[model samples]
Target chain A: MSSFVLFTLTGLGLAGLYFLLASGLSLIFGLMSVLNLAHGAFFAAGGYTAWFVMDALDSVPIGLRFIVALLAAGLVGASAGAVIERVLVRRLYGQHVEQILLTIGLGMAAVALMGGWFSYDPRLLTQPDWFGDTTEIAGANVPNNRLLILGVAILFFIGLMTFLKRTRHGLIIRAGVENPSMVRALGIDVSRSFTIVFALGGLLAGVGGALGTVYFNGISPSLGTTQLIFAFIVVVIGGLGSIPGTALASVLVALTQIYVNNYLTSGLGSISVVVLLAGVLLVRPQGLLGKAAP
Target chain B: MKRSSIFLFVVAAGLAVLPFVPIEVPLLFSGPFDTPGTLQVLSVALVLAGLAMSYDMIFGYTGLLSFGHALPFALGVYGTNLLMLEASIPYVLAAAITLGGVIVVSLVLGSVALRTSGVAFAMVTLAFAEAFSILVISDPLRFLGGEEGISLASEQVPDMFRRVVNTRNIYWLALAFTVFTFVVARVVVSSRAGRVFEAIRENEPRVEMMGLAPFPYKLASFTISSGLAALGGTVYLLAVRGANIGTTSADFTLSILVMVVLGGAGKLWGAAIGGFIYGILNLRLSTVATSNAIDNLPEWLSGPLSEPLFVLGVLFVILVMYAPGGLSSLATKPSFGRATRRS
Candidate 1:
């Protein structure tokens, strides 16, 4: 019973990271109709940036450095997103193939540049001392970091839901997702809103990447491609443009992966998630929480 | 003869005689037929051209943006390797068997993937490819050889595939396959089925409303393309004498996509040209970076310049942005000219 509880907690903790990555991708896809293939690059960049910050700020307290690293990652990702949106993505609005090719090119460029600069070596980020300790939860010992990640993920979920329901900007994004032409006809700056949403997505991805490095123990240039594939699975399983769907799908995928990993080989765990994704795609093409296509 | 036919003959003749002609270019480049090294690069390019042409059939002609095309290609490579190395099958027999296997696999994949259209199709295919890749690398069956993959040398297999002695023979074989791919692709694009494919690409719903089943057409195109890609993979394995996990990676798929798009989608000749250019650049860029010329460059500038993929990425973006029609358009009239004339 304790083992089951432990597995569930671990699954939830993993789901938190998936949620952050997939939500951004889902949000961006919903609002802009642009599939940002370079989304993983931003995630990797965030993690790399955080690593750089932590390394450079070795004299500072670990907790303080961690906070700074997360912020820096978000900011850097946002800036990159803004520039890419303004310069390249702005032109290829309705051309899906062109957008895919362009974004893929950008992704390859980003990864190659990162590889050139960082030398393709994996870098580890140090977690705070407190994060290294474990605590008893319902008679099962749980890592402090996992609990912390779960807590943060819940807060993000609530905050995001509230923002979408209550805030003006969030409302505009939702409206755009539902009907961009209608929103534009009503004189809302849909394009500007798209830019903001893209940046926000990048910001979330960055935070996820940075936090992931601390949790997973290392960051590498290939992380962009790896994370991108995961993000794709999450978004596809969750349903495109559906936040709640993404959240639900992430948890499902994470849990499936955890149980599979525990019972089978680690490699089989990866394959199982992909199989799950395929099953979802075959059964519910629109995703679990997504609306049917018109 | 018609202008197009004459032009085709001339191009085919040039390619046929290229390996025999010992032409050499200056420092910036070398002819494909000039040296052994360049010939090897050109051979790889020809195989890639075949792959690119196959990709063009589905993506360029049929309008399906599949991300799992590498699956068939990888299957062909592994299939050929297994038959030749383990079963001691002849090269021709192994290739035929592998091609058949790839078609069956592709049909199965197409049935699942064709259920979804547009972006969903792409994602589903990608998922399948990723699953296949993981399974191969995981080596659950113990036949896949895992990350190190399998090698096909004379010691391991037959004498025909010996790298040193059969370099020229492999080069010619790759060329033959490339030409065959291009001709077949051209024939398909001009055939009745190709018309249906174009119609599907232009508007699937309208085709369905017109009482034509788009699914069968799409599946047929996918199957044909997969077969051709499998052939390309067989040739690639023959030339390189090896098959690895990277052959089935997303990166390989991206490279094929880049080649097809860069050459100009829907144009078989353009895809072939694009593959050749991409292959040459990929090989030559690394050589250039490590050559004596780069040694004179400043340290800071030299570091990033040494990576070929960086340059390829930049080129891909620039080409997509400025010239969507790719090098094929440049060979003809400007795209803007065509647009203005159409209007």
Candidate 2:
């Protein structure tokens, strides 16, 4: 029973990381109608940025460094997203094949560049000394870092929900998701909204990648491909453009994966989640949370 | 009697006669006309060309992009592998069983996924691919062989094929299959069904209004395309001597779509050319890397500046931006007449 509880908590923590990675992908996909294969590259770049910051400022307070690293990831990812959108993706509007090809190219280029620069060695992200310590809760010991990550993920969700509901830009972005053409007809600066949405999505993915680095204990160049697959599965399972649906689906996927990993096939745990996704997609067609109509 | 048939004869005759001379002596001449390895590579190219032809049915002709086609290809490879290894079946029988399995699986996936359109359809296919890849790599150990992948025993090839199924035999089989598939595809694309697929690509609503179900035809096309792709994978395993998780199945990057575009998407001959180009580039790049020639470049670029990703990426971007019709457009000029524009 205690083992089950521990597994559930671990699953929830992993779900938080998945949420961070997938929500951005969902948001961008909703607004732009573009499958940014390089979204995973942004996630990987975030982890690398955090690694660089942590390694360089050894004397800085560990907690402050972690926060700084998170911010830096968001900033870097947002900037890159903006540049990519303006320079390349802007020209690819309405051409699905072009968008796919370009983003896939960018993703490969990023992987090759990172592999060359990082030399294929995986890097582990360390938590501050305070968070590195373990604590006991409900007769099960959990690491402080994981608890912190969970809290951050929840905070991000609430914050994003509020922003989407209350802010003008957020509403416009939502509107864009519904009908990009309509947004343009209304004389809203749809391009700026696209840029902002792309950056925001990148920022979320970056932070998720950073947190994932801390949880997973290592980051590698091939991390993008692995994470990209996960994000695609999440989006498909959750239904594209549905944020709440994505959140629920992410948790479900994470839980299935965690439990399966521990109890079933071990190394093959993620396979169950993928199978689940396929099953769900088969039944729902549009996705679990997909809109009723196209 | 027909102009096109005469043109085809002339072209075929020229190609068949070209190998008599050394490749360096003429523009069309290629190296070692009689070598087994060359024949083997040509066979592989033919198989890939067949795959590209099928893939282009959806991507180029029908304007539907599918990411899950790789799943059928992988299944085809593993299906044959499993039959030979566990069931102790003959290679010919195994290939047929695998081909049937490929078509059935395609039907199942297409039935559900074809319901969606555009990005949704693409995403669904991707999901299936991920699911299938994971199943093969992880659990379902009975069928997938896990990550290690199932190997072929030397005794599996039939007695009739044993002596002949060497590099040359395999090459001949691949060439025959490619030619057969190309001709069939040419017929299909020029037929009523092909006209429907093209119509759907141009305007789905108009085609639907014209009394075509659209769904059935799309599903049928998807199934046929998938079956051929699986055949390609099966041949690959036989020729390469075995199937691994990565090697047998097409990677997402080089998904047969890349071959489709490289060859000239809508044209069958272009697809074959695309396959040959892909094969030549891939083989030669690896050779170049291991060769001493890479030593002269800068330290950063010295190590294999000829990565397929770089070539593919550049080609993809350029083709999408400029020649959306693909490379075959440059050669065929189907839409343009000789005296109209070019001097």
Q: What lDDT score goes with residue B215 in model 1?
A: 92
DockQ of model 1 vs. true complex: 0.56
lDDT per residue (tens digit) for residues B1-343 in model 2:
6786577557555544433433441222234655555555666666777778877777667767787777777777778878888888988789899999888889988888888877667767776777767777765547667778777654787653344335666765666566666667777778999889877777788988998899988987888788877887777776666677874332542446677776776667777677767765655554555455765777577532545555565566677666656677776665631111111
Q: Estimate, for each residue in A43-125, the C-alpha lDDT of model 1 and write its tens digit.
A: 89999999999889999998889899989998988888888888898887777678788988988878888887777889888
What is the Cα-based lDDT of residue B324 in candidate 1? 82
TM-score of chain B of each: 0.92, 0.86
Q: Which candidate leads the pack in TM-score? A: 1
- C-alpha RMSD (angstroms) for model 1: 2.4
Using DockQ as the measure, the top candidate is 1
**Compared with the true structure, what per-residue lDDT tens digits does model 1 show for residues B57-160?**
99988989899899898988889888888888887789899999989989988988888778878878887887878788887778888889888734444565
